[model samples]
Target: MISPVIQEEATGCGIASVANIVGKTYPEMKAIANGLGIYADDTALWSDTQYVRTLLKNEGIATSDNEIPFTTWDNLPDTALLAIKHHQEDGKDFWHWVVFKRIDGNAMVIDSAAYLDSNTRTDFGEMTPKWFIKVSLLHESSFDA
Candidate 1:
């Protein structure tokens, strides 16, 4: 099982999520996020997807161009950034970020929530994902090569 990167701040799940996907430490990811003006204290991140997308882009990681409505775990891509614990507030959308990866027919979620005893969650029923951004790590040219 892949080790999870526990979020260092209450609102730093976004940073930790990025770190989890990119194999960076929480502090390391936080510094990079801060350098890009992406702060955890900003609640705007809860509703905005661009910040996380931008962070992934900076690391040359590609994600789906648009959000895809989540159906079932079996339908999810091999790797994706999922939006769970979704809710609407003041007419804006907010959701927690979690990473999903399926390998060898085994699927699991890497949640950055600091309070969770186990960051690697496999109980799919407990999570309700609203949508997902497919994370494609390989560059297109890699397929050509």
Candidate 2:
């Protein structure tokens, strides 16, 4: 039930995360991202939060305005975009993007890296998240319907 969209490119984790959150395929999100001039190859896509936020905004999804520092996995919102595998290169910070979801009171992570044998993950003990952006599935305008 948690089929993650695999990143089609080496630097496409951000795009893939957006796809997973929005229920779109990698190519589908990639096309929209390209149309918005948000390319995966841009280093800012991973090192900065704006790109992912922008993509989500364009799709009518709402995310927290600020990055919340990681505390405990149990404290994460029902859905979130988590930053893991963090490191600095040339004094710039970078991280891998993954989606956290709570379904039927069960939590699992969706990782887009193509190297993973299974993308739906539950080994939370193995990951060290640096921060996260809480994803809201509904836009304020949704209530207008």
Candidate 3:
């Protein structure tokens, strides 16, 4: 699980407001996350291990050149939290925040986002690649071990 402090830093009150709160640059934060074994990539809209490694490299984390399994939404690890963009039918983009709290039951939760209007919340089961960017964060202990 991500530390409360780090989680607060990563997922600020709102996406727009986050820009100001996430003191570190996007690349910098990404690097820090990568150092902690989080996979932050901008690949083919999917979570491939190689793609993740590439993303880590892009964020300045050194890694051995190797191929690895890609992580799918359905296969994400329990210790991971994914920040994805959820596309709406009307063509507008909605930011979706999801924490992989449990993998055994194939369940996840969409916490909240800045783009949501007042009194609205999105769920993990209600996400799609069209509207969301797939970013993952790994637990500190998991990264250390």
Clashing pairs in 1: none
Instruction: Give the candidate number with the greatest TM-score.
Output: 2
**C-alpha RMSD between model 1 and the true structure:** 2.9
lDDT of 1 by residue, 3-86 (tens): 899988888888889899999999999899999999999987767899998999898898788899999999998888999999
Model 3 misplaced stretches (Cα beyond 4 Å): 1-71, 86-97, 103-106, 114-125, 129-145
Better of 2 and 3 by lDDT: 2
Alpha-carbon local distance difference test for all models: 0.88, 0.92, 0.36
Q: Write the per-residue lDDT of candidate 3 for residues 1-145, one digit (tens) a residue.
A: 3121122333332221122223344445445545655432322213333433444344443332332232455554443334455444455333333333453564544343434442122254555422222233322222321
Candidate 1: regions farther than 4 A off:
141-145
Better of 1 and 3 by lDDT: 1
Which 10-residue span in candidate 3 carries the lowest summed lDDT? 13-22
Question: What TM-score do all the candidates reach, one by one?
Answer: 0.93, 0.94, 0.29
Residue lDDT tens for model 2, 13-105 = 999999999899999999999999999999999999999999998987988888999999999988899999999999999999999999999
Question: 2 or 3, which is superior by TM-score?
Answer: 2
RMSD of 3: 9.9
In terms of lDDT, which candidate is strongest? 2
lDDT of candidate model 1 versus the reference: 0.88
